[model samples]
Target: MELYVRLNDSTDKDYAFQLPENATVNSHIKAIFSTSAARIKQRVALSDLMVIRPSIFHEYEPVEYYKSTHPGHLTEGGCLIFDYKADRKEYLEKLDYEKPLIDQLWPGQLIVPQWRMSKKYVAIYVAIMAAWLYTDLPDCISPTPGICITNQLSRMLIPILEKWGVQADLVNKLREEITPNYNSVAAQWAFFGLHVLKVLFTTFFFYIAMANPFSFNPIKMYKIRNVAITQKNEKIQALLKYLGWIGARRATYDDYQTNYYDYIIKKFGGVVQAYRAGAIKRAAAPGVPLGAGEGFQTPLEERFTGNTFKRIDEENPKFILSEEYFCELENNLKELLDEADGNIGRMNAEIRRFRRYGIYEPSEKLKHVVDVRKEIYIKDKEIAEAGKTADKKRD
Candidate 1:
C-alpha cells in the first residue's frame, strides 16, 4: 500500500512511500523518518515525532494502526501529517533574541522577570514570623526589652526583604520605624509603630510570595542531597551541601542561642533549669512525662572530609556541543528555510501564471496569496539568519 506523508503543514506536496499491507502506524512513522530526506530525518527523532491524519478545516485524528485489531486498515491515498515538538532550549534562545531593550542593557546579573514569589522566600518569611510570635516582649518601656527584640527582628528581616527585591524606600522605612527611642512617650509610639510595620511588610511579602515565579521543585533539596552523596563531583557536592546548610539554618535558627537567649534567661532563668523543673514535675506525675522524647538531637557525623571532585571554574568554563545536537539544530534551521523558500516560490509562480492568463484581479484569493507571500518572505529571512547563527556556533 502507498501512503502520502506531509512534513509540517505543507499539503501542496507530499512524500509518497510504499509499505506492506500489515504494517502498523508506528512502523509506518519510523519508515517515514528513515526514508524521508536527510534534512527531515536529522532534525526529528522517532520518539519526538507524532503522526496525525489531516482532515478538512484543519482537524486531525491520531492514526492508531498499532492498536487496530484488523489488518490493512490504511487505505490508498491516505495522508499522514508530521510535526515537531517545541524545543525548550530553542525557545530560550528566541527569548534572548526578543528580550526587552532595558533588560539587555541592564548591568550586573540579569534576573528574569518572576511573576510570583519563590517558595524559599515564603519559607523564610514563615520562619521569621514564627520566631517573632514565640519570643516574649518586656512589659516596661523604660528598660526597652521590647525595643531590643524589635531591633533584632528588623536586622534579620531587612536582608531577606532586600534579597527578594523589596523596594529600598520601604526597607528604609521599616528600619526607621523600628529604631529604638530613649524617651518613654516616643518609645511607646515606636513599639506600636514596629507592630504596624511588621503587619504591612508581612502582608506585602505574602502577596508577592503567593505567585510562584520559578520552576522550583519542592523536593529539590532532597534530590540535591541525594545527588551530592552519589555523584563524584566534589565541587558540585560542596556547593549543594553549602546551599542545603543555608536553607537549613534559615529555617531552623530562632535567635535562641544568640539575640533571644539572654532575654529568655532573664525572663525564665536558664533553659537547663527550666528543663530540670519540668522533668521533676513530670517525675511526680503518672502520665507519659510531659513533652517526653521531644526536642533537639545531636548533629550526625560526616563521612567524607576533603573535596573529592574537581571544582568547576565557572568564570570561564568552555561549553562543547555534541556533534549530534549541532547537526540536529543545523538541519532543523535548513529545513525551515527550505520550506519557506519553496512556499514563496510556489506562490510567486501561481501569481505569475494567473497574470499571464489575464485571470489576476483584486479578488480575495489573490490578496490572500500576496499576504501569504509576504509572510513567507519574513519567515525565510528569519530562518536564514538563524541558520547562519547555528553555523557560527558549529564552527
Candidate 2:
C-alpha cells in the first residue's frame, strides 16, 4: 500500500511511502526518520510524532488504530498529517484565559488596562489657574478702579458673601427685580449690585473646588480610563491588520466577518520555518555539525559509510526501523497526498462557485488555498526525489 505523510516542521514536505497493510501509524512515522533522505528526520523524534487524517470541515483525527482496523482503514487520496505533539500542547497552554471571551475568539494579544493621566495635561491646567490668580488678583483688589475693574473685582469678591451664609437665590432675585439705566448715576450702583451677585456665584465655585463637595478626586481627573482602554483596543486591531488577520472585510463590531485564524496559521508557519533557521543559527553549538569547514562529512555521507554519529540527546532512545515500519510509512504517505489533492479540488470548486455568482473580488480563502496547492506540489516533488535517493542508496 502507498501512503502520504506531511512532516510537522519547517519545509512541511510530504513524503510517499510503500507499506504493508499490517503496519501501524506509529511504526510508519518512525520509519520515515530512519529510512528517508530528508534532513528533518534528524531533528524530529518518533515519540513526538502524531498521525492525523486531514479533512475539510472537521478537525483532523489522530489515526491511533492499526491500518487493518475499520477506523484505521486508509483509502486512496486520503492524507495523513504528521506533526510534533509538543507544539500542539504548547500552543494550547499559551492562550490568554484572563482576556475577555470575545477578545480570545479574535486574533491579537489581549490589552490589559492600566489607567493614568499624562503629566502634560495636569501641568497645563495648573499653569492656567496659577496665571489667573497671580496676574489678575491685584487689579481686582485695588480700592479705586474703573467701572470694568470694579465690576470684575466685585465678581471675584462674591466668594466671601457665599461663605458668610448669604443665599444665592435671594441675591439673584434682588438683581432681577431692580433695573437701572446705564446713562443714569444709579448705573454704577446697579453694576456693583450685579458684581456682588456674580461674586457670590464665583465664591460657590471656589468653595466647591477647595472642598470637593462632589468628591471629584484630582488624581482621578488625570486618568482618562475609558480613552486608554479604547486606544489599546485600536492598537491591537491595527497589529492584527498588519499580520493579515483583517482579511477582505473591514473590521467591524460584527464578529462573523473577521478572520481570527491568522494567529494560529502564522504560528504554524513559524513552527514550520523554525527548525531549519534554528539549526543554521545553532550550527556552532555542541551537537550540530560544523559542516565542510570543519573537515566533517554530512550525516547522510556518514550514514552510507556505516558510521553512526552521536544523535541529539532528545532522540537518545531511538527505535530501530523494520520492514513493517517502512510499509506503514508508505501507506500513510499515500493518504496525505490524497488529502492534499482533495483540498485543491475543494478550493477550485469554491473559486468556481464565487465566479458563477459574479463575484470577482479576490477572496482570502482562495489565496490561501492556492498557496497550499503550490506547497503541495513542491512537497510531492520532494517526496519523489527522496524516494529515488533512498532506492539508489539501497541498490
Best by TM-score, which number? 1
Task: Give TM-scores for every candidate, taking all chains together and pairing residue i with residue i.
Answer: 0.19, 0.15
Candidate 2 matches the true fold with a TM-score of: 0.15
Task: Give the lDDT of residue 366 in candidate 1.
Answer: 26
Report the CA-based lDDT of candidate 2 relative to the real structure. 0.31
Residue pair clashes in candidate 1: 116-211, 117-211, 234-309
Q: Please provide, for model 2 over 1-395, each residue's C-alpha lDDT reduced to its tens digit, 9 standing for 90 to 100.
A: 33333332211223333344444333343333332223223332221122221211112233222111011101111111122221232222222323332222111111111113335644654575544433323223424333344345555556666778789986564443332232344554555556556655654554333322211355544432332423456543443232222122111111211222232234346544545445222212111111121111112223233211112112321211223323343454344345556687755543332212112122333223223433444566799999999999999
In model 2, where is the ten-residue run with the lowest total lDDT? 68-77
- Compared with the true structure, the alpha-carbon lDDT of candidate 1 equals 0.33
What is the number of residue pairs that collide in model 2?
22
